[model samples]
Target chain A: MRVLIQLRPAPDVVAAVIEPGVRATAADVAGRLPGVVLDQAFAPVAVPRPVPASAYGDPLSLNQRVEFSYAPQDAAVLVRGEIADDELSTRSVLLPSARRDVAGVFADPVIHSTPTCGGDGPVGHWQDVARLLGAPEMTVEGHDGSGVTLAIVDSGINAAHVQAHLGREVIIDTERSWSPPGVGGTPGEYPVAHGTMCAFDALIAAPRATLLDIPVLLSPHNVAGLLSDAVAAYAHLRTVLEAMPAGSRSLVISNSWGLFSPGQDFPPGHPGNYSDNLAHPFNLIVASLDQAGADIVFSAGNCGRECPDRRCGFPDRPITGANSHPRVLSVGGVDTGLERVGYSSQGPGRLSDRKPDICAYTHFAGSEANGPGTPDTGTSAACPVAAGAVAAIRTRHPATEISPAQLRTLLHRTAEDRSTLGFDHDYGYGVINPPAVLESLGRHTRHAA
Target chain B: MVLLTVRLPPGATLADALARLELAEEDVDTAFGLVPIDPGTGLYAVRVAEEASHRAANTAGGPFSDPPIAPHGSQDPHDRHAPPSG
Candidate 1:
């Protein structure tokens, strides 16, 4: 068990005096005690003074704990750990309590409480229902959500969405969390007006799969999240998921927003610019998600000259070159006819290589005639549709049959070419055809784990 | 510990910047390497020296600080406790 030891600060602790409290505690913690380790108070995980390690438990475990420094700059080091000493180890250290603001403030199950999928609002992709159910493949076996979880990394999804809460059957564990610099409320929510509409697209695709909606956007007054903050939010989502049973197994992630701000390179010391591998924290977060074998889908940016790359749109450029390395399913946009959307982001990323590997639907350049402005007009909207499509495909096949990366490769290999005979710059591996994809899947006997 | 909270800009990444801070400090080289931070939602869990957070109080509410903990509007001109007003 970890205890937060608040020691009276011995002045001269600030200007590196005596190396600060948490440092003091870390220095004071000798291996002789067999419990505490000296730690720098201000690290990514936040360890307050003498950071203690509890190896004996789980999130609910009576032992282990992951601590963060409450105030690195302050003299006090706030350390959180399991209760180790016998005396304080009552049945359960924290007795259940009926706190004041249970409903409006603190609610039950952080991720499950919000509205999403089948909750109350409109499902933008309901039109694809016919495409989903009739896909001969999904119904091959029964719905199996046992070990697979879909991590919808976007704005917070509404927990009340009917499909997410009710629907076809039972998916034992599903969740959601709002990590922010959230602009409005604490949990950055997926409103009818949120984050390029990727939030709802996932539910429309896989209503019954266990889900983890990690809301990265936090601004209350706007429709989207901040670039820098979005990166951090994605990172936080990874940490939160790392601790859960729902976190393990094959995961599918969907990200629609893209950076359109040219010359967005922050000064050498800017927050957006990180190491060689990570262009931003968001990039690192995406890489981390990929390392976890979570099948991820990113909108190939709706910056193609077909439509204006105006507003926050980046010319639908494939995530390649500098944006390469962290391999993921880069999805380009397609029209209803399985042809590439003129507005689909063109590729070979900034480094000009390894362009978009997959393709999905964007409304007639996004809006038909005028196209469906909100849900279909952008590649952001198209990314989620592809995500949902993958979910349906996964449910039909089983995780052992198809890993996220494999799924990505298969989709690309079988894509209908919108370009000449083979791979093109705009549409990627062409558009995704459900029946064609299903047929292709039947040909392969090799299972993916 | 001073908690500051603020929304991040659309294309900016909170973790990337945080990484810069880590670069100069060997103790926290990759502080946010495996662990990433999202700038959009709530108080993201992070660690800073108590004095660091206190000094952060000088720039407090800008991002890591939020309500139920710090006042939404902190009076200090160098208020790290208050986030950039919406």
Candidate 2:
């Protein structure tokens, strides 16, 4: 066990350790101590003695008033060394009594940088994310989500709250926005919550895109909605897509909600299963929507191996159902520093092996939906951020011009590959590179022109 | 309630779906109606009670799982907006 030994060798030696120019080694101070293997490289440090400030104050307890004194006679020196693990307790108790000069022996525990967990503070602000995504350059280049329709299929959106945080007017297509069967609330007027945060993140790159508030998540059960509701919601969105002209259709659906447990689902191989079965009604609808030229993006859940969310119940391959569907872009989370957030789920997804198709900025200080100073966190936030990037590209290149399959290939090809070989489960094809995508689109546009 | 899918011609209604599946109105969630999964493929979905779903599954597509879903975020378990129990 590594430990710090406190010794009151002599006043002159204590003064020498405290002196700026003078150097005092462990051997120079203590001479020799038995059993402890002294660390010769570690310089001895002088520790201040605490003196009681009041007559009633106890010197041993710091709960009362006390003053730290650096007087040579009062001060003690601390030296680093290791002792046998078996004899640690014995030596710690006997060291001071064994040597008259030995004051105390204290533990020197190892420490490390704490990885950002679920409840931790934001890593950086949203503007830093805008910079990381090269949002300004994309906006300046005319890929600013004009005339595009971006749908947020989550709880419900509060346009006022989203507008306040974004510092801009939010365009809600009241005519197109739809709610589930029994869900009550007007389009863009629901309470501020998860859906609003998704709206705010998506508009970062595609501010001009019209938002379709599809609150499939709000149901009669209060905070919960059945998968059947999502199926019905997708059906409404299909009509919305069909209403648009085929040659100019541009609808980007951002889904930040998913199933967290297999308990509710039919077992994997069951005929009615939704997790790994593409034949399931919801999965089929997702495929139908993708086939109809809607750019769908889903969050790769918060069930990461290192520090998973408490609600994650999937024992393995947490990315399941439509969130793992091959047709959609499954987004994982990364902080503004470009490091994958510890809670961003890794892949080898059930529906598609190369899931988490790309990563995007998250865990940043944005939308005060959760509260002031809280980050827009989880792969939930990252999904819309990547969806926003796709919307930005769609501003100039409609789905008719660049098919969803073709666009997905471009994103994978141009991604900033994080691993030595091409792809890995952790980062998939790597972080979404908006600038590279824009550049590629520009090249295609010039060639077509 | 469980979900069941059926194929119908374009512009099919809940009445048309019920008549084709041979299910009565009481066993179906009328509010949910008949949702089109693929308009081009003439595919539609309906919500029915477990027993009705089993009977309809013979002709319709499923007695499929209707699992609950919630937003994926780092929220306090006791918070009002926490993800729903499975």
Candidate 3:
């Protein structure tokens, strides 16, 4: 019995990027030989057939039938049906080295620039933040971040940043672009300094954690993409992480990006809150990562004054913003003196839960270079600092696999609760006391050795 | 869980070496990625780095108690206005 297989048509939108190989473009069956189908093109769920992303890669040679079968159903059907000889294999579409960098959000050395808005500069506060983390006293000696790999998903890191240098080649800096060129060109555009700052914070915070700079958003260009493609890029990040050895410790994922009903172009849900719009890949991605034993840390969006409940803008309903997602270690901002940044997003997460899982000072950060105090704000710069601190804790308690919940609980337990009314939304888990956190978790071996 | 930067043969698939080394996919994913080192080198490469927890395992003693710098205080900052915007 000859079986007919239905394949996912290519995304039509990508056509603008590449030249269509004539097989599918031209008339008959004679020309369409080497064209095979990739399984991922179609999701189990229903999605309108998008304009097929242009078929990149060179054309299939005449008569060179590129055959592929969906292992999902093709295998079962082949066994059920009385079939002749059939070729079966996991299908992957031939793609152009079309891969580009996923920019990271940076702080400190990477930017050397300031927020158009406010805050203390990296140079201005570098000493202060480092001091807060117990720099000289902690052990200037490097431990190799020795074997640690912390993924920094933000604007994209500056490869030359001082923090990138501290650990040498430990930085996996990838740049993502906003509106990239047809073929892969310069990273979508130089990623804004955000991802770079995040990377710097993480590297300095953990010094020993190997840094993987995954650029999810490019700034000054391709900003919209940062929101849409984040989840997929994160999944792709998992594909990278899985390639590591087992018994890996301190598997940290840091995200310093966010949104709130950003605008019309955003998919369905608000980058900040939930919407009738598309559900962000963040929640889904975080839950999956948590299951895989990776700790995720994200920024509380900069939605301070525009409180959805008290005084939000139009359509400012409180949806589960980035900090609201469970399974993530959400962070808000504090200034150089460790005061909560007025504009930093504060929240009781998804279900009226207190958020900004913890707080980190973004306003006054120190630098590796001698620069003036250029102001900055937003949890974008704060999240990575907290992530780096987590790296330090994880580094110390190597044996204990602290679940996201436990880590949050531990932070709360060890936290020097500020307000008489502990756990308030304003400071969430209160300020980050790196020494106390380190002291609390104490020394332990991996797997209780 | 040491971070190793290994160079693959020309036209080598990083996935294959990663599989051979029995490296966890997470490490491969986090440690390595294909980047364009030189504009058109188009060569593929993989980076491998361990996590802090894993880094701790390799340590002879334990987590370093003596760090280079001292921890900063988490005291509350006094609220002040934006020094009068001109």
Place model 1 in a CAPRI quality band.
incorrect
Ranking 1 against 3 by DockQ, winner: 1
lDDT of 2 at A146: 92
- Give the whole-model CA lDDT for all candidates, comma-separated: 0.44, 0.88, 0.46
Could you estimate the TM-score for every candidate? 0.52, 0.78, 0.53
- CAPRI accuracy category, model 2: acceptable
Q: What is the DockQ of each candidate?
A: 0.03, 0.37, 0.02
Q: Tell me the tens digit of each residue's lDDT in model 2 across A47-150.
A: 99998999878878988778998999999999999999999999999988989999899999865354456766778988888888888888888888999999
Model 3, residue A83: distance off in Å is 87
Candidate 3 per-residue lDDT, tens place, A46-154, comes to: 1122222335523433333333432222211100111122322211112111111101111112212222223233324545776776644554533224465578765
Looking at model 2 chain A, which ten-residue stretch has the lowest summed lDDT?
A111-120
lDDT of each residue in B1-86, candidate 2, tens digit only: 88899999999999999999999999999989999998889999999998998788678997789998988873463322232110
lDDT of 1 by residue, A1-449 (tens): 34432322323342233343434333332112123232336221222433335654344433445553344353342222233456343412232122211111111121212211101112234345325333334534433333446665555455433234223442323335445542444322344233324544454445556666555544342534444445455565555546545424456667665544433333224332322224343454465556555667766664555443333223334342223333667777654545554445676665335567667655422111111322234555566667766666666564445655667677877777766557776666777655565667876653422
TM-score of chain A of each: 0.56, 0.75, 0.60
**Candidate 1 lDDT by residue in tens digits, B1-86:** 11223334444444643443332232221333223344333323333333454344433332221111010111112121111010
lDDT of 3 at A113: 23
Q: Where is model 2 more than 4 Å wrong at Cα?
A: A1-114, B77-86
In candidate 3, how many Å is residue A300 off?
Answer: 0.6
The global Cα lDDT (0 to 1) of model 2 is 0.88
